[model samples]
Target: MTTEEKVARRKLSLLELAKDLQNVSKACKVMGYSRQQFYEIRRNYQTFGSEGLVDKLPGPRGPHPNRVSEEIETAILEHSLAFPTHGPVRVAQELALRGIQVSSTGVRGVWGRHDLLTRHERLLRLERAMREQKIELTEEQVRHLERFSPEFRERHIEVHHTGELVAVDTFFVGTLKGVGKVYLQSVIDCFSRYAWGRLYTSKLPITAVHVLNNDVLPFFEAHNAKVSTVLSDNGREFCGRKDQHPYELFLQLEEIEHRTTKVRRPQSNGFVERLHRTLLDEHFRIQGRTKWYEALEEMQQDLNDYLVTYNTKRPHQGRNMKGSTPYAVFKKGLPKATKKEPRKTAENTA
Candidate 1:
């Protein structure tokens, strides 16, 4: 019925024909098989029964000798996970940089076996890895995923603890009739989403420094937490020559690292961007329509009151907030090392 079965029947008939004709040469001629093949088939039947009759393709069985080793394949896969946007040739080159000798063909072979031939398939693999918490997402990976997949735009920046990273931005509130244009210097703790903002007539380097010095640092100081990093866009207010810029000098004085977002990539500083959107939607739009403001001081007062309620009372449903107030998360997320115990003196120990 099957091809193997048919082949086995034909071989069995050859043996019968040889026995009936009483001549091996005549049976081989009628069966269209060489004398050597007939002898080999007969021997296989005697030794392995009908199974040996099934045609096994002539080649090395199992893995090909030319295929990459398991360790190299694993390296390729891990590299792919980290940078899914890289093509086979790029991957090969990257591996080469690491002193791993792998050809572009080898990389393609690995991708093919894993069904990661397309960029989308590779990105989907990355998404799964992120969801499973197997790997931390880098900014570049985040950018790639956000560009390729719309659903991935909901992914939040990963912050482990409070004061780990802080995002700062300058926002234009609106023009005050007598005061010209009003800008807001906004600072937010990326971990807790606790925010601070100040009203200014202009977005200058000093305005950015003033908010951090007067508002952000004091709050962190009260909690015994130190900011290690400040992220901002490449605005003149936030970024300039470290030796000359007021904001840069202030950051240097405070011993905090300043990191600017990539040019033209606003989402690189996404936490601050989201904060600006929230302020616009909840505070500015509502306050603008409902109440008439006479001066910047009046606007600042209302903003301060709103901020108190926002930080202490309003529940946030953000990534790890879990319906907790920013104030609560801020205090709870503080690193244990920050709350240092006083060194025991001889008198105290006694």
Candidate 2:
């Protein structure tokens, strides 16, 4: 029985034994209960009948009033509606800054009670929007998309400091000097966010493989490492040629693992794809030149500088409250590279 039940039973037995004893001190000694407890039990028995011996009435129902109230909950829901991408912990902090105290759990409870879509749901919605543009998605396809989602944190995509996972993709910068338009080959380390890229006149498989094998691989090896895996979207350059794409052949010869995201589902390769957009906006697009090839080498140098700044200086929002840089994290987990000066060349003139 519970402690309260045991106490009640002892109190009841003492009362019965007290009836047979005229001396109060003697009865208290025999029952092993203090005189004050005897008096209290007698008073309770006379006042509320037998039910008074049970535990006190259950406390107020539902969540405590000291916790988030209905008004505060409504405010949180409204705030979430305004900024659907914000997470509960971030919202809680924002509310605290406004002199409104609320726990992350409280905010989550409110959201859960309202059946609101979470941050992952928001990303999934956007992914769905992109998927709709290509073709109708089947249930199995939808499940696979969800499984590979960037927001799904359960599945660990193994990547180490600088060379574990490199995502490569081709993007069009703009019309290049002496060339109508040029395609760019870009590779970024998933861990440190260090990017190595080159511009080419065509999107041919041979050219893509040359960039990966001759330029990219050599650079990585010179830095004293080899990529453990290469992730890419379903692009013609990566998928073997009519017989064997150079990328596939290189992977087989080097014994490097290769993975590709589903066709038309960019979210599977979201990290590098997002980096691509950032580079275009910050470097190429803002250059205001229709033809980029005339200054391709300069652009490449600038891109490398940008990558260094991105890894060593710029703070990542996804990291903790300390605003840590990707390079800081990379250094903590991996061996340091020997410093080397950047090469000076005519094409590299900014």
The model with the greatest TM-score is: 1
lDDT (Cα, tens digit) per residue for candidate 1, span 259-319: 9876787877888888888888889999999998879999999999989988999998777
Q: Quick one: best lDDT, which candidate?
A: 1
Q: Give one digit per residue, the lDDT tens place, for model 2 in 178-218.
A: 65566788887777666667777778777767777667677
Pairs with backbone N, CA or C atoms under 3 Å apart (clashes), candidate 1: none
Give TM per candidate: 0.57, 0.49
lDDT by candidate, in order shown? 0.89, 0.72
lDDT of 1 at 20: 99
